[model samples]
Target: MLGASFLKQKKALEWLSALFLFLLLREWLLPLPSLSDTGSISSFLYLVAGIILVDMTFRSHWLGLLIKIIGTLVIFHAAFVEISLFNPEWILQTLQAVSEDFSRIVNQEWTNMSIISRNLLFSGMILVLVSLLNYLVLEQRQGLWFVFITISYLAVLDTFMPFNGSGAIMRTLMIGFMLITTLHLSAIQKGFIYRGTQSAIWKTLVVPLMIVSLAIGVGYASPKAEPNWPDPIGFLQGKSVTGQSEAIRRVGYDTNDKTLGGPFQQDDTKVFTITTNDKYYLRGDAKDVYTGKGWIKSDKQLESIVHPKNYIWNDTLFSGLETKKVMAVVQAEGEQLPAIFYPGQLKGIEELNPENTTLTYDTISQGILTFNGAMQKDSNSRLFVERDDSTLIPTPVQQYMDHYQLQAEIPVISEKKIIAAGSNYPKDIEERYLQLPNSLPDRIKQLAEKITEGSNNPYDKARAIENYLRSPGRYRYETKDVPIPKEEQDFVDQFLFETMRGYCDHFSTSMVVMLRSIDIPARWVKGFAPGQEISRDANNNMTIEVRNRDAHSWVEVYFPGSGWIPFEATASFTSPLQVNYDRLANEANEFNIPASTEEKEANKPKQLDQMEEADKPVVKTSAGFSWGWLWGIGILIAVGVWILWKKRQEMYLWWLQRKMTQYAQDDFPRRFTLVLTIFEKMISPRYSGETLREYVNRLQISGDERQDLLYLTTIYEKMLYGLKEMEGKTRSLWQQTIERLLRQMKP
Candidate 1:
């Protein structure tokens, strides 16, 4: 009858409901770090387990008050140690450390508490909370407040932080509603339960449970409406770029650079990978017009392409220049880009993965934009289509290219030919490439002239401006805390005179603006640098992985006889393309001064020369904390725990026997009671009105096992009834009997 009472269905459901409700705390605790500045607590799952175990043992009256306390402590020990619980030394050390933390908490030094103590304290708080919930749910039959609070917490997280609480919210509603309904029904049928009509509680809950379940199902299945307003969190923290909203600062490629300023954090998200014979800058697009704030494309026209064809080139500058064919294969890793990243002058597309993907060229930017199917319109639509009403609509492609092959004609640049080919700018090139906003500060132009005072040709003047911007003490490379231009300030002016520090965009924009100030036709070009070499083959072909951190921008100077030549003006960066400085001085000795051997050596192209050594500078071994090591340790701990759990019965039997020997010396009563308890637990639970003899007889044991069990039961009966004293022989027999019975008890 006692066992039957413990198995009361309604009571079991009450405990289950309380446990489920308490587990919801994980949803709140797990995302706390992401929502705040706190670091993640690693043992959070163990803490939750400890709390649940303590709650279960405390509420289980059959275990007796003393055993319940011991069990709770054992659980705490396991959670705190996270190692072998039987290791006395480790357990003692953990207890001492945890105790010290408790002292700190007592002194009101909350911040001084270590992670272990905090988790321990949090577990204690949850133990109290679950007890209170038991009273509220089972005794008082109320849980509306808990449900309401859970909803509010999840709603706040979903609205503000990156935490997606939508699934959690749905789950919370389902469970919370059911819990509340069950508690309400329990309250309504309390009188019936008191009168011993236990089925009344179950019957009363059936309809409410069904109703709650149906309501949850219908609500979940219903279509959700789009958010009625713009994201409040984004509106507050996001910056306006290209007339669109973006995160405060995260390094990546975006179509708009109309407003480019502010510190950006590095993102390791891989954008693409390239397989090629040599390193080259992967050009995305170029912006011809600089608005003093950022860049904008002058021409929005895109020319369609169905097959491989030479890209648009400034024939006046690139005419008859020696070119080498370079083939590269690019595999997209991140989101589909609006344009393909090509190296050098794009000759044409050799192959595409889908074989049906369409391509178009942005005439002004010279960027190749891809499409899913054959373009329905004259030109392929951009990712963001600007309508006539001045509103932008995003056009998502159905299929993104997996990989594409490119056939490019890389122009072999000659510094001698570039300098000797005087700046006889074409009408169109002069109009477009030499553009500068009217609002540009006059001091900026003066600074440009001052920097290039000794320069004669366009190439030399451009080189002088590049060297000045990247020169030490004048500007520094920085990606964080870079200030944006004010309404009255020019972007380039602020970087050049005030901040004097920025990333690639800052130096590149400044170089372009400075070049235009002196009538040197240069434009701001953005792409990825020669990314880190990830692997190399026997044939010397290299595999390069380009991440968001590799997203960069630079200046491209358009010389009439040399086409558009790429230049690197950012500090700590070297251009892959080489210019022959020795030949330049020999070709025009009167105008060009010979550079020193050291300078000429530095200027030599290191594209192929540095491929083998690329991994050395890019990869560094650190003696720091690693998640991989932590995961490995965690896996090992998990396996140990699983093994212990599987052998729990045998381990408990061993521990019981060892403790019995110790208890016999000073505390025979404890030893006797413990033996009887193990018998009831391992064999069968005691029933109401059943004597010790009757319980033993019900076990129906055979052979020697039956005798051992009966003898242990008799000792338990003697201790419980009147026999308060036992001789040494009787106690020894009792211990032996209990040990033998435990050994014979198979799990």
Candidate 2:
């Protein structure tokens, strides 16, 4: 029943042909490996050979199954051979390795050999599925599977990681072939075209050409989507380096995540060492919101510093505070561009080499100072921090807020007591800090409120929540099996209830949520922790060792009068979110000079001119052939050749028939008259009054011509009077005799 219902009713040969064409076109569309790279070429060819072997196994005789399997194995083994194209020893080794260490090869990190090996394995597995398909299902179901495989191969290449190549023409040709093949199958299915027909000129040429033309026309006529993304087409194709957006950051990574997330891992490479008596969290940056799906951007906090002037000498240091200035010289060990690790606030930066780098702020991670390029070796910079009471920055420095905007500013730090500046806080700050997705579980908010119960003020409530996370038996720093929540599943809810196990991201993120649940403003902060001490000076300043293992995430709470205070919530580590440096480091390094008012004004016009110079496009003109025009000419030549090929048989017959018709026009009466006329030229010309028989008798002619002339004379006389049609044999005879007579008569 299965065979009769499907496979028996199907056109096996046609489907096989179509699938082969699909594979061939697909191979053409993908990136080609370099000819010298034997491994890559062999890997690709291995897929092709495997596909053929699998196809034949099902389609050919059942008795040949063992032979097909061996052939496939031999080809696969040959592809994996190293020094020689065909090595028996390497084949044995590859067979052993694939059979024994397949799992190890799959789990290994991406390398040249691994990438090619995995590709070979994946393609081989796909063919294995194809080989089993015939035995498992009917042709109707198999047809669907074949289509799915073909489409999935294209979609994965097009979607997952686009391989850049010739884009439109190859795609159009592939589409054309698919359309033509489909038409052939459909036509044969419905009996529009016969199964036994040897040629399908209409299907091969006309139908496919029409489909391609229509496809192109519709594509141009259709509305185009907006270019919201960079390279909406497959031309610029690769997966985002961050597997998904905003993953946990590691040391030696030049880029930091805007959103803090984990399953965190640590590296032991030191980024930089600091020498400061006060052990405080080296706050790198902060994100204000928890996007349940994990793209936590503080758009409200995002001031673009779009221009260089915004971050460069654009603002003066905070002045309304009784503060002790601290300076530290951070000399980088390696060429890694270290994150500007300042204790309290960044006063200024001076590049050791003016040509080295320019610093920019990612308003996302507040303290991250991104350089255009990596820092040079032995590069060092000085940062000044004030160890004072809680200082609250009402808003990020947008423009230079100098004398006019400084109106009776409340002190950032004081000798006596900390201040609550929330009365003066902008409404935007309050809203941005307390943001939580609506999908956040109510139980999470209840948990936060429960943890912070009985705390009278925001700071006390925040401290209570932080302590709760770092509580002795609450949670541990575990990376293994860290709960990755379902998309709709609340991350905090899962960590807090189902599994009370997580890393820095989980603890810090939970603390922020609990703080926000009670209407207190809180955000996530990430950077290196107060690192381990390496050495101390005579004055009691100790240099520290900060490594990737020291990379951490913590929370920050927003107090009304006091700004953002960093809070450490992870266990097995300790850092005061709010750090106080009563005295500066004795080995104080000078801050890079802030531009004076007059100097800034003078530099303004010069900087604008320089920016204009940088923005301008550099154009260089050279003479060469225009490839667009050349391609147009080539396309036209190809079209002309195609048309000629289509009509070649008709053209050949037209030439032969044209010559025959011309020769035939001089037959019967015309030939006889031409003979007499040539005779007239030879002898004395017969007057118009002379009879035809009389004129012929007067001619001196050869024996065969003379014999033919008497027989032709009677026929001509009858044809002249009667307009009679000559027989086929007589007409053929007359034409040859006349052409021979004309040639003999030539001078």
Candidate 3:
């Protein structure tokens, strides 16, 4: 009975030791979060301690199983929390929102909270929850299976879900848990016999040595921060509270107090400064579609060619009014120069020059001119272009009609012959013309109906809507706060009825929808608002700079003889948007101060003056090694040294043990003493100098024959010298020898 009890106790101790070894392997191999962050290290250590206590307990069989189950659950819970797989959708959405909010916050836009703090808070909460779950469910052993199932479900979700930062973290944790579990199981099967003998040496020397080496390496690799770091703020830091005003003023635009600084400042200077020799219209944008809300470009099938002859030009026959010509040098400051230089009528364009230019005229009403050159190049230089805006002759219209086939394809007008005037418009266009949103405000519709009560024709109704919008009673450009109801479908309805204050998008959308309600063909047109004038360079050229704030959208209305006409229906400015030519020239002269100084010093002629300076060579410096690199290198070196030292020590010990096994006699007592001496040397301070005789005398055996005593000692010696291959066989022999010795030997 006593032997059976001892064997059972030994087996339990072996199992407990095996469990701890498995845990140690897991921690070493996997990239789990540090013990500090997770409290996992303490939990695991406590679990090992608990196993030891259970082994000593009177009822260790059940108690040991309970402790192991609890410990395993705790470990699982910690891993789960670290990965953060719970409520994945909410987590992803929250992270996305935080990223967007961080962008806004960096730009000085409104954000509810700091993104970093939010992320940290969320991570901490998850960590705490995981800890709690481990403590409650895992410790109690009541929900171990449930916990496993939950983890499995989360793992599946993580695989199927879209890639995200949180999902990545969760996957890492799940993989870690699986690896740890596998390693732990393997270690448990290996048993704890070897580990029990080796633990003291590893704990005292091996682990501490590794930890100290790593610490030293880290200390050597870290870099010190500079005592006086240079100020890193850029040009914007020097400007006033309204830095946008300074930016605008630098571009030769007058800033107003109401403009509001930062990115929203509106420059009052004209984008283009035109010096014309003749009285001709400088057209900018063309508005073709006539929504009840506003005028926008018409949606006509884009033709290969966009010229005046393709559409109605004027109401008269061929006349000499076409001779009204103008040669203008127009300098633009902001926005790209449109190929259609103006919105009104034009006859011809000549002598057009741009540094980087591409012209595309697919729409009959307009052309796009994209300047590929830099805006800073044409500060004050004059670009000469001739335009002829004259009354079109009826003969030209008749000639155009004779040249191309015409059908009354214009929407909402009846069919008629091609003519300059009195042509019947298509009636079918009227039915589909007015298409308003179903959720448009009743008040807005009522207001629109009231404004165009007497209008019969589509043109008249469009005019009424345009006039009503342009009038003082409608709207302004000031920012207004309006909380949109959750139930609202269309943004236009909310703006027109509730807010009544918005930029071009709101106004244009509202206008188009309203016009559709009243059987008018209208569409939205997006383009750049006029830019401010900047200094010009030599060769008679000027620059136009367009910023993001200049984006504008409006509406267009089509007319019978004139084609699409533009109308400003949203918010009218006090002054016409134009670039100040004189101011731009003055700024250019001011900018030329340095060049003028050099020219005067060199006695060079003013006519020979160069506009741009040559580029200078920049000094280059390579970035030195970073702290992270140094630390990595240090760690590698430390690990290398440790491995080398461990290898050398292992080799020395192996050579010594081999020599002892070969030379030492197979005398059981002597061999046992040699093994004990080696173990004492390996363990150092903890090991006492206990000889075989002393140890045997201390155990107080009742009776032991010389043979039994020799046999037990021999088995022990064989195990120590690694002569015995199987621990179980050696242990069984030791036990039988011990029993006989105990029966025969006296104290």
Candidate 4:
């Protein structure tokens, strides 16, 4: 009965096949958002398919074509423009923008195109794809190739990216099998219609459907064991430094840094906001041990600290340093982290909420982990607190420290002081910071020594390494497309010698490792850069909003007298930590600490005209003189040529008629003669001895051309041979006849 009903509808099986193909196509789009910035792709694709199906269903071809055009325009409007589709003014504006961007694409200025233009192009491609799918399913009655390509695409994404394609694969398999079955049945139906026969295709489909269902059920229900062989892809890609495989993860600060180096998308989710007078990097933690691939902590001992009584910076040993007190307040706005965040050289905590919050500071990492209430310490220095005590049971650490205030003593040592303080060994610092893997390549050390060849002191050596890594064209600041180092490759070695492009981790790690190779005590520090300033309060304090995108890492070089100094080694990034170069410029003549070239240029006083020019906004100019006029002239010429090519036949005919009319005003005889010459040119010149009447009859021309020439010959003979002077009305009739004859000739 079901098979009979499908055959009765005539179009049911075809539509069913198309619907199944649509579902299969949809699976290919499911994982797009995770891999790119495109969002709501499924909705856009659905809109396209729905409109295309509507277009295919219309009875009138012209009407359906018109509907398809309008529907495509509507989809473009919805996808790229944030306005109502019915607004004619905005639609025109959007189309103009698209046209301008189209020219940019023609010029191959791909990077300059805005995101809107790119998405517009994507929408156009989708429109074409759906239209093609229409033919493949309804006309060609085949979609097996499309299904195979989609499965391959999804399988690769699943293997390489964080996308899970198991469910998509199952759905695709089911839809593909059904779609093929329906197309076959529809083909059988078409044959029956052609042969004037009748058959129920649904009856043939029932057996395949039952078999597919049983197979799917058994495959889904069957107990499966783990693969006998390990993942071949993992072996091919090789293990990370942590001896484990890693997939690309989202960009943010996480507790784990055991495995590093891969692509990550920017996350703009705000984590915290800081209000302070001066910009400072929000330090999270530090890692001392380098495993050639990533950083790890060698020490985990936590020291307890209570606010107002104990200062975190008191343990540091330093001398001959200029410093000032700075203060900041951090407010947690997003998901709270498990640790407390502070700036450099934390003096002490002035305020913490709930009055029962406990802070444990890791001596090596300098990272502060928070917990509830007064807690006792185990032999390992881990915090232990009574859970049952009503007073001790405090609010969540994040909630308790949701908002806090602290003061930091920022060091501002000049280059002269740093250089004068020679290398004085701190045994623990040297042991921890100078440690490198035995397996590290020797070229890294050689490169370090080569970079710092002329430098005499540790400070100069460190600066040399930092400058070399960040020099223009030597390295690039890329967030994504950074590959994880293979098992045999050291992360820093590969970056410095092989890839030469990556994010902060690549540059910072290379610098730290290089510095270590030359015996400069350096450690890897991870934190947030001084974030973008959102606003300033009435008191002149700046409020900076820090997001996950602001997460960064840098090299911290320790000097004997000046303590640890932060240096930025990432390309296109500047260190926020300020150094007062002029403070000791004249204090020590022997040391002669010349300021960096950048600082010298920055310190130079500007003249009145120079200052005025600097105050003005800079305008971007093209290379050399503008040739905009030349481009305009070229475009005009191109337009004219195109018009001539498209309408050459009509223009030629009009020109010939205009010339005939001009000659007719003065002499109708000359006009008639010109018509005869034109007709001769169109076919062939009269034979040497042939007269006009003979030429017209023997021309071998047929249809309207032959008839027009024969008629005109009679008129010309009457005027020339019969000597019958034409009246005014007869002359007009003669001219009309000539014009008709000319129209019959091909341009």
TM-score for all models, in order of appearance: 0.45, 0.36, 0.29, 0.46
Give the number of the best model, judged by TM-score. Answer: 4
| Ranked by TM-score, top first | 4, 1, 2, 3
Computed on alpha carbons, the lDDT of every model, listed in order, comes to 0.62, 0.47, 0.36, 0.64
Best by lDDT: 4
| Residue 287's lDDT in candidate 1 | 91
Tens digits of per-residue lDDT, candidate 3, 549-663, equal 3435556544444344333345432111111112112212211111222222332211111101000000000111112222333355445444644464454345445645564
lDDT string, candidate 2, 537-613, tens digits: 77766576666555566776665545655666664344432222211111111101111111223312111000000
Measured over all alpha carbons after superposition, the RMSD of each candidate to the real structure, in angstroms, is: 22.2, 28.1, 28.7, 23.5
Model 4, 1-747: lDDT tens digits are: 554422223377877887887788688666654333233463466566775576457645566556776777666554444446666765555566568778777785443344445555555555555665666455555567667877886776565443446778888888888888998777656431223333446767777888888998899789999776423443454533232224546567777877778876556678888888666667888899999879888878777665533564663523467654567888887756767777667777877765677777787777877776665566765566646543433233432357788887555567777887778868988999999999999999999999999789998798778767755456755544478999999999988899877877888889999999999899898877766566677776778787776788888888886678888776545455545444222422111111222233343321100000000001001011111222333355345445654564565456556767666453655676667656554456655567777877777666666676666667666666665576788667666777677766776
Error of 3 at 70 (Å): 99
lDDT of 1 by residue, 1-747 (tens): 665544333455566565556556566565544322123233444445454444444435444334434444554554333345566655455466578777775674443444344444454544444444444444444466667777887776565333446677877877787777666555444321134355866776677768878888887789989767534532444533332225446778777999988866656678788888767778888999999899998876665554433333433224556555667999988755657888887766666877666676676777777766544342344544334575545562644678888877666566667877898988988999889988898999999999888778888788777766645445756554478889988999999899887777888999999999889888888877767677778776778887876777888888776678888776545455544344423332211111222133343322331211111111111111122222333355445545655565676566557766776353655665666555664667666578767876787567687777677666666766789888888877776676666667675
lDDT of the structure predicted as candidate 1 = 0.62
Position 348, candidate 2: lDDT: 45
